[model samples]
Target chain A: MRYVLIGAGPAGVVAAETLRKADPGGDILLLGDEPEPPYSRMALPYFLVGTIDEAGTYLRKSETHYDDLGITFRHARAVRIDPAGKTVALEGGESVAYDRLMIATGSRTQRPPIPGIDLPGVHPCWTLADSREIVRRAAPDSRVVLMGAGFIGCIVLESLIKRGVKPTVVEMADRMVPRMMNAAAGGLIKKWCATKGIEVLTSTKVTAIEDTGEARDPLRVLLDRGAPLRAALVVVATGVRPNIAFLEGSGIETDFGIRVDSHLKSSVDDVYAAGDVAQGPDFMGGWSVHAIQPTAVEHGRIAALNMADGNASYQGSLAMNVLDTAGLVSSSFGQWQGVESGESVERMDEARFRYTRLEFDGERLVGAICLGRTDQIGMLRGLIQSRVRLGDWKARLMEDPQRISEAYVASTHK
Target chain B: MLKSLHIDPGKCTLCMQCEMACSYENEGLFNPAKSRIKVFDFHDRFVPYTCTQCAEAWCMSACPVDAISVDHATGAKVVSDDLCVGCKVCTIACPFGTVNYNHDTGKVIKCDLCGGQPACAEACPTGAIAYVDSDWTGYDKMRRWAGKTDSGAAQAHA
Candidate 1:
């Protein structure tokens, strides 16, 4: 059987490798939108920081790795797919047939509707192409105006700040990283950026970017309620939406993304979805598109297994985010926002900027977050993932949550 | 069957407890500079990394003196100091940078995982570093996600 996989990102790469392992004789074709080799989007920031060259961004080092695996790699944008015909239509009007298909198209940055947003000075920090442009323009002392202080924005903030470019971040949200962190954690991040000489403007809006002067003059980024900020470059990192627009008319189910079942198979037979583009059921009961690398890799593996090995099932995905904003480390895990009537315990050292908040539904920890104090992160995940009953130790945890090791031991033994 | 040290970077807090425990146990000191299991502080992420005891074992392959060998029971690539030439060939060959030269000992060293009971895992306050079955480190995560697909809220939502 020939397996055709789209989007050569983390999920696609893993899926291709997995198919080779499961069925060596089967033909595999991996398609990517870009001209470069199958590189990792996660390593783009490292490339931006000059820690490693563009070669370091590749998911696999050896040039012949794919050739050795007997996996065919093609650089083509899949414009449409025909589930009925069991084929994928590429941009050049070429089509390929397959017995099994995997959609791992991943995601693209959502461009905000604003005037002058498409000017030469503006860019989004997403693909390797964007990184290349950013590296060219965002030199030292190159006044950069970053839009969106969410997870992606904060990450870009670090790379921009490292290049000695004092960036003025503008976010509509009341705090930085509103989705990944709580108000307190967000406040801590803003303060940390301030200490590091980066200006963070929460509850702020960028009205328009106007270029009236000569080529050398910086663009004037007009704000709603403040003076226009002069910026050499404007980075749009507002948010990301899955690349499922092409899946229309394909008869594949899609809600937030391409919906897949317990086995990572889509509603359409012989077709599967994984990565950011695939919206699979959540371990917490609904469905979500967890675009994180680890989750996507797992999705690819499981999808390939079921497509080939036949009895593999997908449980669900856990929502997890780990961030290192500048120097202050922060992390959040499943249901961290807390459920109704869930008992919670927190320890805050305002002076040290250290905090821990644990959410418990009866004896089970539903979610937790940590800022500065990063202890028992894995144990917390273990407890929540396994839904281990804390038993009487729940009361002890309520008294003091620092004894998570003790809690892990006690709960696991029971 | 050998056991494995599972590393979940998402759970690391940059506490450096793993480094301290590793140094104390292996080097008889509390210096982080001497620890074998290095925690990469990427600023935005703190990922504690060490030798993965690769199935293809590059360090062992590059060992000119046949000093590097795999422990059959644990799957960890161990170095015999007496046989090592201290040429730093393994250090250069390791793709993950887990292998390092101990200038004081005139030999290269990496995490032996403390003879299967990793002190780094024990000292980790956050369960980011765990020792589990070598064959399946993702079993816990899989089981957890599976549990969520079971009764109650899952069925209700379905």
Candidate 2:
């Protein structure tokens, strides 16, 4: 049967590979818009920082490897999908009929309505080309201005610092990574950034970037309030929106993203959606989520399994964000926002520079954030995943890290 | 005669132990996303690559502030964070693409051989990475073949 996948990203790659594993003779056709072989979007920052070479960014397999597997990977964008006709129309005006189709269109970076956004040296960290452009314009003494202090923003900062670029981050929110982390946790992160000499302006917004002279010289960054910050390069890493406009009038349902059932199958026949573009029910909070790589990976597996006639469900997602800053580790899971009857357990030693907080909602652990000490996080994640009843361990957790550590060790030991 | 971490791509498993160790030492966390010694996996080929630490260092020469210098004890090229300004010249100059900037600390972080005993080499589970004497890395491979041909095989038969 002919299986045509829309994207060549993490989700699409996994789906195609899984289909191959399930059925050897499965005629899998993977279509990608990006010219390069499927590279890790997660590693783009590494490439910018110069730790990973250009060739190193390629995902686990190259284009030739996919060819050997008898999987047809076409570098073309799907302009339209004729679900009624049971065919996918390519950008070159060619149509390929498929027995099953997977839409893993992924996402594009969200650019806010700000002036001078289209100007030179202002970029986002979405595509590999964007990364290359950012690095090309970067200099040792180049004043760098980064808007949005979210996960990608922080990661960009980490990459820049390793390459000897001190970047100033401006967030519209009151704290860094506020959306993912709670106020208490974000406070610690802000303090860490301050200690590292990073100029983090919270509750601040960039209005425009003014550059008249050479691109190497300092460009003035006009803010909503106060004086303008000068920088040579500016990166907009505010957030990402799902790529769902292509599915318009295709009868494929979409809300925030392409809505999919538990099996990752769309409302349309012989079609599925996954990755950052596919919106599914949240695993931990029962809300809709879009941008988690692990969830996308799971979606691919589920889509393939259901397509290959296996029973599987897309078991939601845990909004997990892991960040490693200048000598600091930060992680946030589940809802750090509204917590009903919230109980918190914390272990912090300013001398050792270690801090950990496990947030529990009544009997079950719901959310957590950790820094410096991360060994406990792996276990804490388990507690949240399993929804393990805290029982007496909740009280003991407040005073001792060993209690949770022991529980983790004992559970795993079995 | 600057010392640097020589990665044998054949030995890398992409376990990210080196990244964790590097971040832990510098950033005090186990986040590979922020590590200096990034392990690039050419997934299809299963190759892990890092810095080669060339003799004629482009990064050292390219540093406009002269903050990058050779360590006398280990021969490793070190970036003095205090003296160094956050300029990305060294990052662009390094052909191997091992040098990187940390946004949080506003400094460059390269493999300084981890003071002769590298944490990445120690943390590597597969024995794919190892620190050898600068001049004698190839000698160990030669000795393995020599043992099989000249003495060990013949002695066992006798």
- Candidate that scores best on DockQ: 1
Off by over 4 Å in 2: A61-63, A348-352, A401-403, A411-414, B1-158
Q: Which runs of model 1 end up more than 4 angstroms from their true locations?
A: A214-217, B1-21, B24-158
Query: Candidate 2 docking: what grade?
Result: incorrect
**Cα lDDT of model 1 overall?**
0.78
Name the DockQ score for candidate 2.
0.02
> Distance from true position, residue A271, model 2, in Å?
1.4
- Please, what are the lDDT tens digits per residue for candidate 1 over residues B1-158? 77888888789999999999999999999999888877766556677766667643546644434467778778789987755644444553443446776657757788887888899999999899999887778435433433442312223223
User: Judged by DockQ cut-offs, is candidate 1 incorrect, acceptable, medium or high?
Assistant: incorrect
Quality of model 2 by C-alpha lDDT? 0.71
Best by TM-score: 1
In model 1, which residue pairs have backbone atoms overlapping below 3 Å? Answer: A262-A314, A324-B44, A376-B125, A376-B126, A377-B126
